[model samples]
Target: MTDAPQTNAPEPPPRHIESAALLQGAREIVIEHAGQCYRLLVTKNDKLILQK
Candidate 1:
C-alpha cells in the first residue's frame, strides 16, 4: 500500500582479517574520481605519505 520500498537488515562488521576471503583494516578513506588507486602511509608526527 505504501510507496516506500522494503529493505533488509544491515550486515555486521567482519571479525577476522587473517582470512583471505575477507578484507579489514580500513581507516580514513579518500576516493579519487580519476580512476586511480592510492595507498596512504602515516607517521607518528601526523605526517601523510604515499605508500607503495
Candidate 2:
C-alpha cells in the first residue's frame, strides 16, 4: 500500500460579505447596535468608515 502526500494548506473561514452583495449599486448602510444608530459608509477612496 502507498500513502498519499500531505498538504500544508489550511481552510479559510466562511464569510458572508462579497463583491456582488456590497458593490452592486450600494454605497452605505445603517446598523443598529446597543440601541444606537451607526452609519457604515464607503468613502470615495474605497475605504470603510463607521460613524454614529
Misplaced by over 4 Å in model 1 are 1-30
Q: Candidate 1's error at 15, in angstroms?
A: 38
Please give me the total number of clashing residue pairs in predicted model 2: 0
Error of 1 at 37 (Å): 1.1
**What does candidate 2 score on TM?**
0.54
**How high is each candidate's TM-score?**
0.27, 0.54
Per-candidate clash tally: 0, 0
* TM-score of model number 1: 0.27
Tens digit of per-residue lDDT, candidate 1, span 1-52: 6788867979898776442222234433443446876665445675556643
Q: What's the C-alpha lDDT at position 31 in model 2?
A: 77
Among all candidates shown, the one with the greatest lDDT? 2
